[model samples]
Target: MLSANEIEQVYWLADSLGEPGQRIDDGLFLARVAMHARELPRNLRRFLADFRASNRSPACLVLGYPVDEVRMGPSPTACNRLREKTIDEIRLEIAAILISSCLGDVFGWRLQHEGSIIHDLAPRPEHEDVGLGTGSRQHINWHTEDSFHPYRADYVGLFCVRNSHRVATTIGALDPDQLSKRHRRLLSAPLFTFRPDPSYLMSKAHPLPGTDRGGILFGDPENLCLRFDQDYIDWPDDIDGIAEAVETLRRVIEASLIHMPLRSGDFLLLNNRRAVHGRPAFTPTYRGTDRWLKRINITRNLERSRRRRQSDFDRVIYV
Candidate 1:
């Protein structure tokens, strides 16, 4: 995905940054990346172009980029404890930000993860059973990123800095032609609702209504977009018909699953509206060398989510 010269250029960009983790004027930063992006490999530019044009595939992987092994050190045990000021971390983030700029504006949810636009995804033993990425023992069930929210990201970008033991990232995607006639009709109807996942709540707070009645399948019928969370979806007991449909949809999605193991210097960008992604239960050694990934959310348009955040310029959405 990156040539030797291109990698050097990216590192230079990272070095030029005055502060790490402190949100920059992304508009200006994006402009710089846009200028340098032309110097990147042709195939990479085409891949980003195709992905931005449509949301069809589960993900696009960019491999062979450089990761400064010595500078990255060990993966942080907790995202909150570490600031992204390290040289390697900033370089990795700059790489991600540059790739994301090709797709859209990068945004973050104020109530989720660390509320940082660029966040870490490393196993935290203490949250093994929680719904967040820190859960290690329990597989994080497949779902669209921020499935409970209407203004979810258009694409989710993940940059792997370290993953010595290949841990598989699971993805489920089903074409409309694969769905049964009845199942397709039901999912297209407004019969589904999602509860706020644990990520949206405080430690002991009760679950809140996350979305109004909405269709699980949206967009063009030929290339339907998905919105689902098996663990957080709320189905009325009395509505047996919709319940059966949901179950059928789940079966089809599971049957078409694809798993990919990301290695260092690989960035996997997923179309959040087109597929659901999760991870298998993998034991983690909280030691510094544990698997670590940096993630960011991208939206096609910044104005569409202005109502959710304090201002159009703000990247974090409180709602």
Candidate 2:
């Protein structure tokens, strides 16, 4: 529960960027905006309380206000000047907000591009092509992000700045209360593998460095942890056991799906371990006014445990 003043500040910040034709760099703008937004003592306490109540489990929580209220522009360059500020300024602002918001210490931030040039950014191909274009109509299968990575994100955040199509929907599959006993049993078994997609081998001109050919189905059965990509998984030749396991996971995902339509000014944060998320395919109009989302991968209190730090140059890796 954010205080009235803190909530007002968030609305004001969004309103500032809502002007037409603004080319604001999301990373820089968020960093500065967070400075003012993070100073509310009451709000900080509320955030800590909520986080503790949830057992520090990662889930989507929207701050400030909704997109319709903010009315931000459709252009990406609207606030470019704001983003051009010094890196130290940006870092300081972001760090302050996270600390005040009880989001734990800042770990890292990233700028993701969903255009033709950078389609396959993650190492796993099954997680590819999910970002909706301006107007495409493809339904993405629900799955985790780089579940194959030994150090997957503990938390993932997406802040929407612009959306022209207005039809992109992010769906998640994970509902503890709704899971069936059969689904639970299937998830409890170990019968899955992770391998680099064949396309990456040819493009990179070499084999992927950290791929595991015979990965298990569930990493932590009691916790019911899942890492699945229907498109990328290679089931063992002995099909009966593996098929049953895969089907069970699929049914559970279908049964527990949750849909979220993100708009500008809305930030969706989720626990990567507890939920598998994906978007329906959307066609990008490619017109200057296209759907653009700024993504930031975070590791809350788990940052120190993971021993990771934010990198200065945000590199785009094609996997």
Q: Per-residue lDDT for 96-161 in model 2, tens only? A: 334333543223312223211112111122323433222234455666655655545555555555
Candidate-wise lDDT, in order: 0.76, 0.46
Predicted structure 2, TM vs. truth: 0.62
- Predicted model with the maximum TM-score: 1
Question: For candidate 1, lDDT tens digit of each residue in 97-208?
Answer: 8778778878887666645777778888777676577767788888888787877889999888888888888888867787777878888887677777776775333233
Clashes of 2: 18
Report the number of the highest-lDDT candidate: 1
Specify the poorest-scoring 10-residue window by lDDT in model 2.
115-124
Over 4 Å off, model 2: 1-4, 8-41, 48-58, 65-139, 175-190, 196-209, 213-222, 300-319
